[model samples]
Target chain A: MIGRQSILEADVDTTGINSLRNGPDDNGRFGIFGGRFVAETLMPLILDLEAHYRAAQKDPAFKAELNDLSVHYAGRPSPLYFAERLTKHLGGAQVWFKREELNHTGSHKINNCLGQILLAKRMGKTRVIAETGAGQHGVATATVCAKFELPCTIFMGATDVERQMPNVLRMKMLGAEVRPVTAGAGTLKDAMNEALRDWVTNVDSTYYLIGTAAGPHPYPEMVRDFQSVIGSEIKSQFAEAQGKLPDAVVACVGGGSNAIGTFHAFLDDADVKLYGAEAGGHGVDVENGHAASMTGGRPGVLHGNRTYLLQDKDGQILEGHSISAGLDYPGVGPEHAFLHDSKRVTYAPITDDEALEAFQLCTRLEGIIPALESAHGLAQLMKVAPTMGKDQSIVLCLSGRGDKDVESVGKYLGLL
Target chain B: MTTRIDTRFAALKAEGRPALVTYVMAGDPDLATGQAILEALPQAGADIIELGMPFSDPMADGVAIQLAGQRSLAAGQTLRGVLGMVEDFRRKDETTPIVLMGYYNPVYSFGVEAFVKAAKAAGADGLIIVDLPPEEDEELCLPAMAAGLNFIRLTTPTTDDKRLPAVLKNSSGFVYYVSMTGVTGAVIKSRGAVGEAVDRIKSHTNLPVAVGFGIKTAEDAAEIGKHADGIVVGSVLVDAVARSLKDGKATDQTVGAVRDLVAEIFSGVKRARG
Candidate 1:
């Protein structure tokens, strides 16, 4: 068992990224995952972004404006609710839920989109482009862009477009163009490729809003910084509520934005346990189910930076399966890679069956309906909570509400 | 007929100079221009030519290389088309080694045995599939080697001592040491770190060590060449071809840029060796 003390002392930079506005060049990536991965034709635009992002981060007005919007519009300082019923049922650890579900468009994704769209407006970029799976990000991006009166284009997997029709319609209602990408397995990965192509084509006057904390360089770091609000809030709230940090911090990992965001402020805290729950679809078979890249994958370079991915012997990306649409990704954020390798955090997988059971338990016991993606974290709490005493605290990020998943869940239960 | 990669290394060893490998995207702009680029590499001091067999999705490649794949794929460049270009290059220049490089899906789609046989028949000397790590070497590496092809393996900065032996075990061609921890085309301020990495790999294997990924300028090549047996320049060469196509003339201008870059790096290598 590698101790947290040894993990914290490792050479890798665990300092939360300093600013939000800096682009690819500034942080050596985009949002921690984005970098200059395109042709020279796009370099000028990327450089322009780097310069503008740096300026915006330093400008007090931009910071105040973003902060104000987070509070007033998007609703900042989302509550950390103690799940008394759940804790009583578990008979061990006292579990608390960070309600990101109560945010404007729902989910922790709004944190990144709000920050990036603000940066985009400051950069004088009139159009925003985004890629999404399950449509949570697309809906969030479209809603923000609509609020700002910026033209928005969203690239979604054709399969996702069909499955998550409500999100696609929501984007359209927001006057955003939803481009269905039909290439390469028609999933989140393909949507990303198409979005990247769009960004290259429309680099000028366009800001690409990456959804998750994954991609290349700056994106992973940048998105983590933006989403770090979750962690910062958790730290303060936990201190106020319990007089000490929770014993464990748990969140679902898709591209790992929510997990990374929620885990960032606690990385330096040696005593706090951090867990990232990956989607373990039906089973452990790579082809059949799950987006448990960290648990099931090898370290390989994908999208940009080296991260865990569901790839074959030859590096061809396998189409990852998950019951939750948001968790159906093959790769994860690079910072998560750094964290996993350094043993700063424990990454485990929750099977779809387990997540479903957890979802039902949360709804029936706590009277809270969670997004299928967020249910994975609740599933982890179920596993880990029973071992610890009732006094021990656990913080789980309830990423989004289950309203969007009602139809899917009903169909799964054979009630629709 | 059977020229071992070791024989080439031994011959180069007597000369006391590092080999210069140039990578070009096949059918970039067009197939004719790709052939011209291939024809021009050796004259420009490129001892080895790595022809990128463009695929629909190249996961390891950055934007420049990804676009190059897109362009090649758009121009209807297939594995067969790339092999034809290799065949054409072999007609005029037989001394320079030509390695087919790309992802494995296209090759797998083409049937491994048939692809190996066809690649050998088409005059390709080596294979460097970016995705094919040493852990799963039996899939294509063994079959390719069985068909008289040299299977080149890439060792990254993260590949520790425990993994090096297995990586070098069946590796017949020169080992490609990725210069950094990240993806390809990332810039490095200096090759000092890469030179150290080269030294570490050299301690493990007798195979020729080629340093690549982020070796942009001639100075970088020269600095890396001091410790490495070869230096591979990829993105910059691809950029040059892309630059040439910006003008209506995709002829000697593209080839000329690559030739000039190669000459600059070759001079640095000479100076370093001397």
Candidate 2:
């Protein structure tokens, strides 16, 4: 068992003063995994963002303000509930849910959005830009932008806009102008390309509120730091409930914000295992299946950071497909790539069928409708929990609510 | 021996006129048509040629070039296929400088050493890798230079004085000044801004500064040529090829149309000072 410590305060300390998750050394390299591989035009802007983030890291007021927002505004310290039915149904490990879905935006994406928006405000930026896949991050960014009264623009894949209609409406309702990117395969990568282009064009006045723990430096690190509250709270909540750290932590990885948030605190804890579930649309058959970057992809550069990417033999990025739009990105967080290489985290692929079944199982057994993205972890839970010792426990980072996925899931299951 | 890029720039400098560097995606409609356009570029008055190596994901390009790349890829264009076009172009006329321009992934996939050797053997003169920044010079820039290929660097408006040295440190052949902050095909906002940025780059380095990314017409070329060492028109030419296409196949207008635009641009550039 790991030492009993105040989970939330211990690691969320941005000072990196005493944290086990030390990474992205000086040049944004996570053991040759993460590096700034962007166009030269964005370099100066990125450097400016890094300098501001570094300064904010040292500022006590910045941390205090962010902490306050996390608690009072964003409704942090999200509950870690013991899923009694899930544990009994699995007949293996005791399954616990880190209720990030219960957060303000009904997802974990709000954590990073809040942090980055605050940074944008702090940087004197009046406008904000973001990219979204399933539009969770777009909704979160639009929410924060509305609150701050900042002009916001969101770049979403045209295909995603057609599928994630509710989110598109929500962003518009929140006063954000959503731009549909029709480039490439008309997915998350294309949205990111448009967002980057917008940033390069309006770098002086606009702040790119990247939704995931990906992108160029400061972004991967900044988003991870903001979202680390999930892991920090998990550390404390799991200890409060089970009297010690859980045996393992599982979360779905798209750009891996939620997974990183839940896994950041447990990186140094050798006893606890970190299992990240990548979207396995059909079964990771690279030709037509999923977005399992580590499983099917090679190390390559995309969107700024060099990480595990779904690309062709000639380095051209391939569009990844998944039933879950949020989990369909071809590139994963750079830190996840680093952890995969270091063997600190074991990544597994969970297919669409498996996730669909898990979604139904949890909805009926526990009366909880999980996001398709989060269902990936629950799918993994069903696979590994039964084989594990009954004495062990697993904490699934329930990253998002399922309301956004009902329509898509219905279509997938032939219920629509 | 000075590379073709350097030779062309020196020749232009001697003639007291700015150079006209024309860019076209290889195998846009088809390889045969692309080769025909390539062979016709120099005679139509292109001082140097920047042949685009098409990749599926070209992050730096705008709509025109992206479509061109997509069309080339759809037509089954590969790294070998683009290089083959260059080699085919080299069979007869060899005076016009040839520079292969595109993202790094294709060359990286082709194996850098092997790609460089192949590029040099194919009679290619230079490279304009958009994604490989100064920080990543060791990846391809230094190696290409070592192989005697002019690794051209792009200096944008955002490339400030502080970052100019690092951007120019390992740069060779000539400097490409992206007149605007956005991607390729964006309209040049101001000829004065292009002039000022070009002067800024020239002040830092002695290398010729070739301006691109929005010179649309001969008048635009003439205006920019006054301030730049070379005038580059990519998107318009790519759009020209796109417009001249008949049912996705290059029509007779493809080569003639490109030559017509280049002829106008070449004349406009010569009128800068000469």
Candidate 3:
């Protein structure tokens, strides 16, 4: 039981406006969690990249270019559809899905990719690179690179490359090179290491399009700004659909880009609750079996930012296990850590078996196959929505499509 | 509290020759073999010793050093055992500077303040924390400096004029100029460009500058010695240790082969003008 202040009472912006969204401060600290913890070799480039991002944030032309691509290329303003069958089945809260799974490249990842690819072009970078776990982010990046006519590379763990081979083929088909990282358990963390190595080596020509809302400063900040469009759209869409904000907003937390996007706009609304569901693999009670950073890990720095990390007493990061590859990361974003500490956001662990159950249930109930990453959020919704009144409404961020995860789920359930 | 790093650099300046800095992963192949290599380093003509604290995931490392660390970990080399190697080496040769080079996680997990105290007590001269940058000086760099241990900073090609001062601010004893942008082990091919970068760094700091990354042969060391105050060798030495092993155990020639290579590299530094 990690105790935190009741954010419902604390840090309330009385003006019905968001102050949490305006964070982090100039040093990129969301309450001492996010900061640039890189090597001296990469510091200048990071600083330079930060400067470019800051200037781009103010330039209307940059905004125009990115906004244009988001609408026409990636299909912006993904719909807010009321899940009638799901609501009826839950028999408690009214359910609506801010359908990010409908977006191009089949997830909310393209929202960030389009924003970053525009920035890369403005910076005159010729090549782009990124790391992926489930291959959603890699495909998004590869798609944007193909459209922008820039060469692209994606670093994926050897294990992921084999399991998510279809997405690997998708990236190669989209004219991007896919490199398999064979380090540390062959997962997301190892791929991130290889990507950073590539970024250091090719700093002059390559712009690293980080897929998550974690990493060194400017990244966590900027990626949030990019993905904030999700929340920004929901604010208006929910008002049009429900005539007001939903009672609660729920999203799955991996590296926490989608969750941040879902919760960023409603941060100032004290009436609306926010929930984040993290992967609890076998169980967090066992040593190194899960990815529930907030509930099961301690604060430490990794891959640039200080956040809750699943590491050993020796400070070595323990590899996270999840039936969903996208959520199989040992660390969460720094802002999520701040929210967890402040109690503005409630975080819970969703076990693999529970998520699998929700994955099947959502498909049958709503006729929508959800990505296993989003199934964690659905699992949490299944647990909590039944406890709420029928008049209350909850919005679940259906973060990605299930196509990339179908084979893995098939193998897991012995359906293959 | 004068650090051995400062003393060695000063002595090398007086000698008008570049210092030979050797890096070998502690507990590589096994603890006993790693200890033998450490004991033989100074006698093999190495002026400064860099003992790599073996880590499970060395992000900044290349294949050679990565394999060496794995070898050490497979032999059950914990952070304490690696530090003990430094303490054991101090018992015999206290003059040769020993810098513990590795990532920040092990020390962070060990607790920064406690790690610094133990490192100082163990006779470790300095640190080259690859992960913590100038922005995170509060994390480990400043504390290590206050404990009478030198915090050496690594400068690279991308470290521009604007960033050089910050990199050099808390840096003492020596500045490490990484010869390339990539991970360690990939050799620096452009000798002239590296020489100019070393000279550029010398213009900013009075502290000696040691150059590393890709100086594999004696010729490579002598050429880099023309520009640097110290020549640091890591990956090749680690690779030597890896190749000398048979079935994961150190063969009879493991320690001797590394010592012979270090002597040859040292002779190259000796041949170069100060």
Candidate 4:
């Protein structure tokens, strides 16, 4: 469905040796980063989901349906725009944008939601539940669930509910019951905890539409497969436009879905560099002050997988801080952990102030308002683009449109 | 190879009575009050104690235990502090088996090997790590079992018989059959189903089958105890502690609140097969 390759044939590292893309080996582990670290109550259900997903992966009808929905419903092949003004402003590399922002629901999240909701339908799940931080994923999920006519519930942090109000309203309009969770700093981690609790309680009829490339096994793998369309599109589109691969690719990391999606196709390309920008709230050096899990934290288990977590020495999960509610989670996906450890992908911390500056810069220069999450990638690009040769190019995944963030940006900039 | 958990369950089986297992968060409300509750549990008729090592995120728990962990963490509980409590409890009582129960991150953070050794040295009889299913036996269960600690596994209503063998393969101490397919503190949907589940699990392993998750009231315990080798009650006891708190600090009645509830539940356990 993505890039003229079947899910099994295209990415299969037959030797099982050195394909960075072929991760999460049979145990759902990405080199000790991901595993099914869940309770027994959820094990049978997780295993069942995995079985269904595997079956769905092989079934051509499932792929055909997903591809149809992707092209017709969500609008695939978002334009690969050459950001000429932004490149001129940077005064070095040619900056190209994979305009995931142009997709329906204004984000790359719809790509995954479409794929997962179809899987839920195939599995005969009666109800759908998801966790959201900035409400993009929630809205995307609600959109797909609405089209599919599945009853939907979304758990969002109370703090996020207040800050991301417009997106919350959007989810409501799309027919999702948004439950505000007030637990643990009222952020993404708490919302995920509540969602997992809900899944455990409603195991029989409910399908947990996890919003990130994290969680237990098959999720990181499944989400990457769904989102791989981003990178695959970038590959063919860039080849068509530029006649070669970009020197580098960039994406912001929250739970690292968009980043993983953008990076998966480029993993085997040794010439292409990958960068993931994580939220450095104030600073990573400041204890409990950032959401840059790989930059400031260690490997620990939470929310059903082992990954880099912002945690204290006692292993208690620290409530991570980030100006962008979408990037406020304490952990990144396990594949990112493996990538960080293997030194295949370079992950860096983008501070709140830096992201805000990039947000304004992109809005003015490219006339493209970026999501706060995607702005982190732009912040990283602002630093990297100036160092590269003018002929070299960097493709950044503009993961979402920034309309949902204008109010928060206005409040932050004293415009309100 | 017989752990304190095995000995205690064997003793309860010999007496033809279901073990009354009580769970109290290691540092709920405050340190001293939580310690007092731990010291008071055995005297109040709790045959086995599931000491909760409070973690920041307990995904499998309901609101009651979630709040208890929050209160404990707010009161400055850590994995080290939990082990210290176990050491302190061991100083007073030697027979009551203490199973450290909670999510895995805190223990994983403490370093699994070191935590297992420290837990064994500190007098923890077993572990009920809510997160580690049998697929991950090598992570902690095998190590803890290698160090002579009971690695108790939870068997849910969803764990069909086909998968029961794998779930029970590496499991030690006893088989914890969650009476329902939900988090802690929800009311059980059917009492008869629990009896049938217990019988189904008993068909597979000789390990004592303890049923938990929603055994709140004395009548609930009595009904469940009729089928299970042990009846585990937690959220209500933690809630009793929560109720007895004044201004979020432990009141004089905090320890006694949990003690009295365990006593009431024990009375039901006593009448289970009578």
Question: Which one is best on lDDT?
Answer: 4
Q: What is the lDDT of residue B134 in candidate 3?
A: 86
DockQ of each: 0.05, 0.62, 0.72, 0.92
Chain B, candidate 4: TM-score: 0.99
Interface CA RMSD, all predictions: 10.9, 1.5, 1.2, 0.7
Better of 1 and 4 by DockQ: 4
lDDT per model vs. reference: 0.78, 0.87, 0.88, 0.92
Best by DockQ: 4
Cα-based lDDT at residue A227, candidate 4? 91
Q: Mark the regions of model 1 whose C-alpha exceeds 4 Å error after superposition.
A: A1-39, A286-288, B1-274
TM-score of chain A of each: 0.91, 0.95, 0.95, 0.97
Give the lowest summed-lDDT range of ten residues in model 2 chain A.
Answer: A1-10
Better DockQ candidate (2, 3): 3
Q: Ten consecutive residues with minimal summed lDDT in candidate 3 chain A?
A: A1-10
Clash pairs, candidate 3, are: B187-B214
B1-274 per-residue lDDT for model 3 (tens digits):
5788888888888999999999999998899999999999999999999999987668788889989988998888888888899899989986998999988877887999999999999989899999888888998999999998999999999998878998899998899999999999886869999999999999998989999987888888889999899999999999999889888789999999899999999999998783
Q: What ranges in model 2 sit over 4 Å off?
A: A1-20
Worst lDDT 10-window in candidate 4 chain A: A1-10
Q: At residue A330, what lDDT does model 1 achieve?
A: 86
Give the alpha carbon lDDT tens digit for every residue of A258-354 in model 1: 9988987787788888999998998777464778888888665455455677866544567788888888888888777667777889989999889
What would the TM-scores of all predictions be? 0.64, 0.96, 0.96, 0.98
> In order, how many clashes per candidate?
24, 0, 1, 0
